[model samples]
Target: MARTTIGDEPRHADYSPCEHAVTPSGQPRDPQSACPGRTTRPVVCNQHGDTTEAHHF
Candidate 1:
């Protein structure tokens, strides 16, 4: 898989956020993880990371 920086602008128009900060050793930290309190902001893209919606569950 392609790797991307945490805060850098995406190089591709079809880019998606990696969901979490990479490790110091340079590895994907988690599949569904992100910086703390990041989910509170408005979502610009729903292609990856967290989504903007609610469900009963």
Candidate 2:
């Protein structure tokens, strides 16, 4: 992710989505809740190796 400034606000650069999961904001989405994208996709956030609830799957 490249760092860039858009207007007065500083945008935090993000990485591409993880192959095994959905990486939003260059960070993995919490598995305990449905993705904010409003889909039931089985995505996981791997950033920092955080984990989701066991029944998330």
For all predicted structures, in order, the TM-scores are 0.21, 0.15
For residue 15, give model 2's deviation from the true position in Å: 22
Compose the digit string of candidate 1's lDDT tens values, residues 1-57. 554322232222224433555555434456465333222223333234333454222
Give all candidates' CA lDDT scores.
0.37, 0.33
Tens-digit per-residue lDDT, 1-57, candidate 2: 634322221122232222334454433356664333322223334332223344332
Q: Report the lDDT of model 1 for residue 42.
A: 37
Model 1: clashing residue pairs? Answer: none
| Model 1 misplaced stretches (Cα beyond 4 Å) | 1-7, 10-14, 31-57
Q: After superposition, how far is residue 5 of candidate 2 from its true place, in Å?
A: 18
Best by lDDT: 1
